[model samples]
Target chain A: MERTPPHPEVSAFDLQLVLEALVDPVRRSIVTQLAVTGEDRACGTFDLPVSKSTATHHFKVLREAGLIRQYYVGTSRMNALRRTDMDQAFPGLLDALTTPRAVAR
Target chain B: MERTPPHPEVSAFDLQLVLEALVDPVRRSIVTQLAVTGEDRACGTFDLPVSKSTATHHFKVLREAGLIRQYYVGTSRMNALRRTDMDQAFPGLLDALTTPRAVAR
Candidate 1:
């Protein structure tokens, strides 16, 4: 069985933490992909240029920040953007942040 | 004579830098205050608990991120939220981010 890392509850999402997690170009890319897909993607699916360790760190940051949720599925850790939670927490934020042209580096 | 530090042009506003600047609680507070006032405010006029140097650092971050504009007026460095630029760059971002309860730490 795959172990799931701890994540913050939607109600406990910290704005600062979320923003910090999304500030990085790589992390923002991850979030943008997830938002665009609108479906949970396996950890290995992202075409991140960073090493495995760095990619793991970015996922951890996003999970801890309550911006993404991770769950195990047949030994694969799948990640999805917590769009509903984000929308509820800060109206229009998810849409603005996920705008491809705006966030694209 | 007061000197205004250089800031990014509106067209050059970058999402990563803007989000990074707003991720800090103190910086968010400064932006929030400026948004609420809807007018330019002197740096010293903010009731920040941090030391002058620290506050200055935060202001610099905001300015460099293109989230705020700072201008010199009679030796006072007045700061104002770059609402127009932000709105044009990332529609609805400033309003969502400046919502008091949402970004309040």
Candidate 2:
């Protein structure tokens, strides 16, 4: 049996961990992709700049931080952004994260 | 001459750098204090758990990330949250940062 990795409860999400996970550009990109699509995506489909192991690490960080939810669909891992949960836990966080970056002068 | 340290232009603010600076608890606390008080504060007035050198480093990071502006007042260094600048550059970023920390769970 393929065990689902444990995820932190949304109510218990730590701001530090979420910020730490989001501090990585690759991880932020992953999140941006999900937010842009508004759909669950497969682990292998997103455009990641890092190697396989590195992508795995980023997904793990996102999952543990409760920023994303992952589940297995056959052999492919699907990831969905935990938008509502995160917003409930930390208001405006996803809005901040998903907004267009560095636009003003 | 007590020259003011360089601050990144709001037009050039980088989300990656901002997230990196904000990931630390001490740095976030400094930001929180300014946001909560809505006034400039002397460097020595903040309740930081770190050493003087460490606190100085945190302030430097926050200022460089364009999250705060620092100026000298008499013999003391005063820090002010760059709320307007940040709001213009990265909407919702400060709102998320200033909101209560980890209160959901």
Candidate 3:
């Protein structure tokens, strides 16, 4: 039985939590990929270096932090970057982190 | 005999290290104060909730990450945000994090 996951509200966005979620390179990669592609990606479609369970954990953290929104499209869990929520809560934050200078190194 | 501490080169500025340095609320507060005042301040001037040793540790982390530069003026340790270096390295990162939204939380 699959169910939709919970997400923090835009008003409840926490910069600390967002930073924690983005501190890990893998999670940041997930975000950077989404920002670059500007598309929702399926859980398995991301080129992550971790195991399935680990990737799931990363997605959970991003979702909980309001950085990403997750929904079930058929059997695949699709992840979308919550760019609007992020910008409203912390202006220019996503743009800063997703830019080449941020993701390059 | 006090000596100037080492800082990572601008070219060697690492996002992971910068994120780690900014993740802590206390350290982020130091950064916010700097960004708000736009002035080089003595170590004791910042209003931190941590003890002296903890505050010192925070300064060290910010300094080593190239987020801030610390120098001795007489006997006081003065701290200055390396805005130019950070701007060159990460572009809008500092401005984003030091903005009201990032610091508001």
Highest lDDT model number: 3
Give the top-scoring candidate (DockQ): 3
Question: Candidate 3: which pairs clash?
Answer: none
User: Against the hidden reference, what TM-scores do the models get?
Assistant: 0.91, 0.93, 0.95
Please give, for residues B1-105, the per-residue lDDT of candidate 2 as tens digits: 448789889778887778888888889888888988899999999999989999988999999899999999898999999999988878888888787664222
**Alpha-carbon shift of residue B84 in model 1 (angstroms):** 1.0
Evaluation by DockQ, superior candidate among 1 and 3: 3
Interface RMSD of each: 1.6, 2.6, 1.1
TM-score of model number 1: 0.91
Summing lDDT over every window of 10 consecutive residues in candidate 3 chain A, give the lowest-scoring window.
A1-10
TM-score of chain B of 1: 0.91
Model no. 3, DockQ:
0.77
Model 1 lDDT tens row, A1-105: 238778787778888787888788889889989988898999899989899889989999999998899998887889988888888887888888888768664
Count of backbone clashes for each model? 0, 1, 0
Label model 1 with its docking quality class.
medium
Candidate 3 chain B: 10-residue stretch with minimal lDDT: B96-105
Indicate the residue-level lDDT of A31 in model 3: 97
Off-target runs (Cα >4 Å) in candidate 2 are A101-105, B101-105
Model 1, B17-88: lDDT tens digits are 888888888898999999998999999999898999999999999999998898888878889888988899
Candidate 2: deviation at residue A55, Å?
0.8
